[model samples]
Target: MNPTLHSWLERRRDWLGLAVLCAVIFVVMPLAFDVFRLNLIGKYLSYAFVAVGLVLCWGYGGILSLGQGVFFGLGGYCMAMFLKLEASDPVSTKIQSTPGIPDFMDWNQLTALPLFWEPFRHFGFAVVAVVLVPTLLALLIGIAMFKRRVGDVYFSIVTQAIAAILSILIIGQQGWTGGVNGITDLKTLLGWDIRTDSAKLILYFVTAGLLVGCIVLGRFILRSKLGRLLMAMRDKEERVRFSGYDVASFKVFVFCVAAAMSAIGGAMFTLQVGFMSPSFVGIVPSIEMVIYAAVGGRLSLLGAVYGTLLVNFGKTYFSESFPQLWLFLMGGLFIAVVMYFPNGLAGLYDSHGRKWIARLLQGRRAAAKPAPGAAAQG
Candidate 1:
C-alpha cells in the first residue's frame, strides 16, 4: 500500500464509520422496520443528539455534565409551548372558560396565557429558542463554573442539581408548565397534522438528517486545531493556560454547543413523542442520557447514537420480561462498561476491528500474488 493512501485512510477512518452509520440509520432501518418500530427508532435517535454532544463536552474537553436533560427539556418545552398554543386556539379551546389558553392552564382556572409562553406563538421564534435557550443556560453555568476553575466531580454535581431544581420547578408551576403531566395534547406543526403515519415518517427522516448533520459538525470540530486544544486542555489545563489559550472560553463554548445539540434533540422529541414533560427534565433521565453516552463510548459520536439505541432497546426488552431485575442488570452493565471497556464501544472497534480489517486486506493481497513456484510452473 502507498504510504499516502495509508495516511489518508487513517485520517479519514472515522468519517468512513460515520458514513456507514448514516446509511444504516437512514437507509437500512427505514427499509427493514415497520412504521411503529421506525418511529421508536426516531425517538431513540433524538437521544443520540445528547450523546453526540456529550462526546465533545465530556470525551474531549473532560467536562462531565449531568444536567443535559435541562437543555433537552428547555428545547422541548419551547417547541411544545408553540404547538400547545396552536392546539389551544379559540376554536379548539372554545369549551374552556379561557377559550385561547392551553387546556391544562384552563383546567387549572387560568384565564390567560403566561407572558413567557407568548413568544412561542410564533413558529420562527420557537425554532430559534430551541437552539438558543439551552445554549444560553449552558453559557451561564459554564462561565460561572469554568471562570472559577471548577471542574471534575464538582461540575457534575452542580449540573445534576440544576436538573433536579428545574424538574421541581416545572412540576410545581402546574398552571404555566402543565405540572407533572407536562405540555401534552400537541397536535400540529405550522398547521400540518403530526399524528398521521405519513407525518411520522417525515419526522423520522428529519430527525435522522439533523442527527447526521450534528455528527458531521462534530467531525469538523474534532478534526480542527481547536479540537486538539480541547484535548490538551482536558489533560493539562495549566499547560494550555501557559500556552496563552483561553481555557475558560473553550470550556464554555463546548458546553454551549453540547447544550444546543441536546436542545435540538429535545425539540425533536416533542415533535415525535407528541409531548414535553418534567418526566424527561429530571435527575434520573438526565443521568440516563449520560449513561447512553458512556455506553456508546464517549469519544465516538457515532458510537453515542448506537449506544443510545442499544441501551434503550435493552431496557425495553428486559423491563417487559423481567421488570424486577432490569435496574440490577443496567447497573451491572454500566459497571462492566467502566471496568472492562473504559473507552466504550468505539474504542473497542478501533482497537480490534481495524486490525481485523487490515489482516483481511493483507491476506487478500497475499492470495493475489503467485504462491512460491506456482508462477514458474505456469
Candidate 2:
C-alpha cells in the first residue's frame, strides 16, 4: 500500500487538520473582517454545504447531479412560504391564513387568506417541510432513475430537465408562487428581527457553524464503508451487480443525501439574502454546481470547498469590478484551470507547497554539507 494510504487507514489524522482549520476560521474571521464582510463570508460558507454534498455525490460516487438547484429551491421556497405567511398575517387567531382562503375556498378579493399556505405560518412545520420535501423528491426521483439504469450523459440531461421544468412552472405561476419576483421582504426568522445588524451577525455565525458541521459530517460519511460502495457502483455497476450488491439503492441514498444538503444550503442562503425567487433555483445554478465540483477536482474533499470559494469569489469580485468582462473572465479561468491543472486548485496548492518545501530542504542540506571534502579528508 502507498505510504499515505498506510498512514490514513489506521489513524485519525484528517481530524487534526480540520480542527486546526476550523479554529483558524473562527478566530480570524471575527478579527480580520468587519461584521459586514464577515457576514458575506458567512454567506459563502452557507453554500459550502452544497459543496460538501457535491464532493460526495460527484467525487466518490461518480454522479454529477445537475438538479441540486431544484432541491435548493424546494428548501428555500418552503421557508420563504412560511416567512411570507407569517409576515402577511393580519394579527389573527387563525392557525393558517392566505390572501384568498386558498384555492379550495376560492374566495373573491381574497378578503380572508389562502388555506394552502396555513401550515407554513408555524416555524416547526416550515422547518420540517424544508427538509422532508427535497429529501422525498430526491428519493422518488432516484428510485425511478437508478432502477432504470440511467447513467452518464443521460442522467445529467434528465436532472437538467427537472430543474428547467421546475423553473418554468414557477415562473408561470405569477399569482400564487410570486412568479419572477419570488418571495421577498422577509421580516424575520424564528421571531428575530432580520433588519438588525446583530441578527444578521448571528445569522452569519450560524451559517459558519453549519458549514463546518456539514464538512465534518460529510468527511465522516466519505470515509465509511458506504462511501466505498458508492465508489464501486460508480466505477463498475455491472461488476458490483455481479458481486450481488443492489446498485440502485446506493445511488438513491447518495442522491437523497445530496438533495437534503442542497435543500439545507438553500434554506440558509434564503435566510441570509432575505428572499427567494424562481431565478435562484434553475438550470444555470445547477450547472454551476457541477462546474464547481469539476473545476475543484471532484475527487478531493478540500478541493470542493476550495473550488466553490475560488469560483464564487471570482464571480463576486470580478462582476463588481468588471461587469462587462466578468463572464469572459470566469470562462477563461475555468478553461485554463481545467486544461492546465485538471486536478484543480487544491492539487495546485499541494504541488506548489511540496516544491517549496523541497527547495527549502535542499538549501538546508547544502548549508550543512560542510566543505564537501572534510569527511573524505578525515
Q: What ranges in model 1 sit over 4 Å off?
A: 1-8, 368-378
Candidate 2 structure quality by residue, lDDT tens digits, 259-297: 888888888888888888988689998888877777777
| 52-148: candidate 1 lDDT, tens digit per residue | 9999999999999999999999999999999999999899889999899999998899988888889999999999999999999999999999999
Top candidate when judged by lDDT against the true structure: 1
Model 2 has a clash total of 8
Q: Model 2: residues >4 Å from true position, as ranges?
A: 1-13, 91-112, 354-378
Question: lDDT per prediction?
Answer: 0.92, 0.77
Which pairs clash in model 1? none
